[model samples]
Target: MKSLVSSEIVEPYAQALMSVAKTHNLADRFGDEVRALVSALEGSADLSQFLANPFIKVADKKAVLQRIVGDESHPFLRNFLMLLVDKGRILFIEGIGKQYLALLRELNQTVLAEVVSAVELNDAQKESVKQRVQNITGARSVDLQTTIDPDLIGGVIIKVGSQIIDASLRGQLRRIGVRLAA
Candidate 1:
């Protein structure tokens, strides 16, 4: 699904990033780097403030990013960050990360299925569940985001994209238990 980020504003940057990523075959890599940068910015109030500083030159901010995230960050990521800093739009890095993921999901035709269970599934079991989801969704591929929630009581609550399949005992019990309690 398209994100809330305006394509008119983001397309230019996304196109630029996409070209560089295609050249390096690192679209996903660049996205990961963007995410890391976003995390770093969010984790440090001082750093975020520094980036958002109106007086800071774009070159200086770029230098700061290079110093922090290091040279391994893809060139596109470096430029993208610098561009935002230059334009005084640094605060939107978090939104950019979210938009980047949305773009990645679109390009890959992949959807995230959140699997919340009472306990962690073994690797094999997780793969099995993924396969089942693929079969049901008719999606050639699926990305599973798994989490362990002890309060689930049992079974799994499969979130197929934006929808949820809450079969957890806590959920069912809440429905029936409510009837009984009433």
Candidate 2:
């Protein structure tokens, strides 16, 4: 069950839901709702347990999810939840939400950029990094996630989608070493 809950397995489901949301012109709303659902699952251990417990019947889990999400929940999301309950994939909901958001960003021409630096970045530095990523990726906007890794020694490494720009001192030194060995 755990192995089956990976992003690869969950992506098709997210893609299907994204199609429905996009067709109905509710992509943003559905994206927000999915994020909220993920947040709820993270915030409530009991709720997460209940959703992932196979011993609980599917009907019962669907009812509970309906109550939790309320009557006003988006139809696409509500039906999507029921489908997950039916398919015994409740545990993969978080991955589905993450995948859905990634799809949404792609659809909107935005990109998620990861920046790893030797030291903590100030607000200005972070903004500059984000702007550079946006320009390089041709993304309308860049959602940046920053991390500090002293091993980097200096400079930063940026990752946007499938591409990586490694400017870190560690990477440079490693490249130099490899060239010298050759």
Candidate 3:
């Protein structure tokens, strides 16, 4: 599959970046930078397409990166961006950033939990979800990402890695329907 190949290419680049972050004792800083870069890529389809366009010149891509990252970014990260451009692997930036963040989470013993609810959760509810995730994964901490989906009607769904714990009212109704049919 395309994703299999992407992962193959992405892992090494992410690990290499992680190695550099560890060497500089800037794992957290690099993680933040990667998150920001990924956010930017996701926020702008044109920018993402521009970086991935094979017809675009490398210098142009590098210039765009320089402009986006600016001179304030660490020299290592700036060089890393240039290296990706030079190697014609800029298309994998999003995947590489995600993989790098995953690696950082592993190193830090934290789990990323995606929570979907019918309504926005308050601080107390978020803390409760975090505690539940920590209990489920046995991680020292949980990075909670919350989203609202009103179709759920009520309750919440928690996803950590491949695991999904669906407590939504719709899920419950579906299960009940299946049970009655069976």
Candidate 4:
């Protein structure tokens, strides 16, 4: 969790790996490999012990990791694991995996736009809404991820990055509530 909190430190490494993965047409594979590796590290007590056992050599740890994850593991994962072994951040493998996946998702032409509303959108409505997001973000295309929250009352909230377009009746009610409470 500490490593996750230090995400700013990992972004550049993740981005560089993502760039190489994209260049090799292996982004999806690399992401999957990282996920699998993290899962293994989390699920196996033996692996964790072996990784952090100070008495064990780093070369031994690398060999064990290779055997477990296999030669088929993505180059990014291999390089990342080796780096952790070198720098003694093997404990943060999960953090690196997560950061890499996040970077990969962002680098792909995919942007997660959460459109919250009082009701679900029909197919046509969803497509049109996603198109609008793409237009605003200047992304190649927008893959619209939808959420229906009845509490929103009326109107829509469009969120991309740190920006949000909230035009909801519930939001207005909240403003009214705040004003009255004040």
Candidate 5:
């Protein structure tokens, strides 16, 4: 129920931010700023708690945001941050930023692929995985996020959305074991 309420608050704010980004042709810039803001919020429990504190004055919150965003931030985003402060929605900024990025990826026809392999992939291997993901998802671009998992023994596992492509050695062995058991 709390998650449902949070999403209800998050989605409209994210959509509103996306609408502004689209209107000003600043989607990429806004996405970058939002990502940075979300990173800050996540990295600093103090900052997150400060923003969420009801006793904190709105002016102080805005001032902190200004310092964090710097003076050169676009007026629209500056105003957006101020609006969040005023509405007491600043606490949800991280969720809003994440949702906005998801919307941006959708707009750009990009897919995020989480790839786990037994070893670090070289550029060539990374590109191959990305190209394969593109072919599978029909996305214009693929945002390949890679991780190393030695337990896989060899090969890679590609996960996109709810689909999982397990090309790893351990997965193959598990499948073979299942077949033998049957």
Candidate 6:
């Protein structure tokens, strides 16, 4: 699902950061590092709050992040964090991270596919689903993330990027109801 934070706000920051990473030949590395940072922030509410709090000094927050990431961290990533601090964008890091990953996936010719099945998909079922998604979307590959939703009753719902293919029994029933009403 798309983030509530507007792409207007998120994309520019991600694009600028992607440019820097590309210039350094470190797009994949920086992407991984940013994912780690987002994971860390998500794992700790206090740390996230510390970075996002408007009353706190940006320098102090940068110092804390630097200490946590250590001296061995990539200079580009360190500087990127500092840039975020300077621009007062530290709080939007999660959205930035999402955009960064999305950019990376697009660069790699992979589409993120979210699948919800009435029952957990087996390996063969998963491969079939992925192949169908690939054929439909014309993506070179599908990065499939699956969830089980018993309320669906049967079949699966597929979401690739913003497009959804709803074949679940519940969805079928809804369509039938609409047709009957019409």
Which stretches of candidate 5 lie above 4 Å from their native place?
118-122, 147-153
TM-score of each: 0.71, 0.71, 0.93, 0.53, 0.83, 0.74
Can you write out model 6's per-residue Cα lDDT over 3-103, one digit (the tens) per residue? Answer: 54556768998998899888879898887788788779878999889988999987798999898677877998888788888988888887888889889
Residues 1-182, candidate 2: write the lDDT tens digits.
65564856798999999999989999989877887788788789999899989999998999999987888889879999999999888878878888898899888888998899999999999899988887787878887778899999999999887899999999999999999999
In order, candidate lDDTs are 0.76, 0.88, 0.94, 0.78, 0.93, 0.87
Q: What order do candidates take by lDDT, descending?
A: 3, 5, 2, 6, 4, 1
lDDT of 5: 0.93
Q: What ranking emerges by TM-score with the best candidate at the front? A: 3, 5, 6, 2, 1, 4
Task: Identify the superior model by lDDT, candidate 3 or candidate 5.
Answer: 3
Instruction: Give lDDT: candidate 5, residue 57.
Output: 98
For residues 1-182, write the lDDT of model 3, one tens digit per residue. 99999999999999999999999998999888888899899899999999999999999999999998888788899899999999999999999999999999999999999999999999999999999998888999998888899999999999999999999998999999999999
- Candidate 5 lDDT over residue span 75-130, tens digit each: 89999999999999998888998899899889999898999999999999999999
* Backbone atom clashes (below 3 Å) for every candidate: 0, 0, 0, 0, 0, 0
Best of the two (4, 6) by lDDT:
6
Q: Model 1: per-residue lDDT, tens digit, 36-58?
A: 76677767989888876878777
Better structure of 3 and 6 per lDDT? 3
- Per-candidate Cα RMSD to the true structure, in Å, reads 4.1, 3.9, 1.5, 6.1, 2.4, 3.9
In model 4, which regions exceed 4 Å deviation?
1-5, 109-182
The TM-score leader among the candidates is 3
